[model samples]
Target: MKSHWREYIHCDPKILIGKPVVKGTRLSVEFLLGLFAEGWTEDQVLENYPTLTLEGLRAVFAFASECISQEVWYAASMVNQTQ
Candidate 1:
């Protein structure tokens, strides 16, 4: 069976002020997502972050996809701030 990304990504409320992190580590999903937003290829990301495996990288994509699919909301203030 394939590993579910959700199994690896979760929030700690105490750590990172509640950001979603990889299971058993302090790595945040947003950190991985930021790499993609910055144009880092999977190979590049893996090369730079030797701790992350291809599966973990794929998990980032899966996790983000699920979040957006599950009624993600963009606060008006935050949206405006981005503009």
Candidate 2:
């Protein structure tokens, strides 16, 4: 969708002690990641957080995916060492 997920995830020194949170909401991307990891569905998350939208959820996932992807090189190195 050519989306700018960065718009949805950011940290501000003045807010939440600089945790990466949703841009317009106080909810942190880490919180959402935890919910998803705990087996919470997108529908369930939205139901619990009426302020959140599908787009927001998608953005968080995209942002997290990008961050995790950057960590892949380290994992690759570990895998190479084990070979």
Candidate 3:
């Protein structure tokens, strides 16, 4: 997935309390991702949410990938052992 998510996703304080959502829709990226986590296929999602496009779905994943890539993580044991 590329950075194309920028074209399909937007954040607005007025929308879902600033949660990132699909452009022009109340569909939050978190919500879409949750559907997938709950075992929803791309086809199922599209069928249920008629307004969502294939590109939009792909964007959700790309956005998530970018977010995770920019974060930092450490093992709890590593911190405790250091102390």
lDDT of 2 by residue, 1-40 (tens): 1258876778998888998887878788899999999999
Candidate 3 runs further than 4 Å off: 76-83
Q: Compare candidates 2 and 3 on lDDT and give the better one.
A: 3
Candidate 2 C-alpha error for residue 25, in Å: 1.0
lDDT digits (tens) for residues 31-66 of candidate 3: 999999999999999999999899998999999999
**Superior by TM-score: candidate 1 or candidate 3:** 3
* Candidate 1: regions farther than 4 A off: 1-3, 72-83
Clashes in each model (backbone N, CA, C under 3 Å)? 0, 0, 0
RMSD of each candidate relative to the true structure: 4.4, 3.3, 2.5
Q: TM-score winner among the candidates?
A: 3
Per lDDT, the best of the predicted structures is 3
For each candidate, what is the lDDT? 0.79, 0.83, 0.93
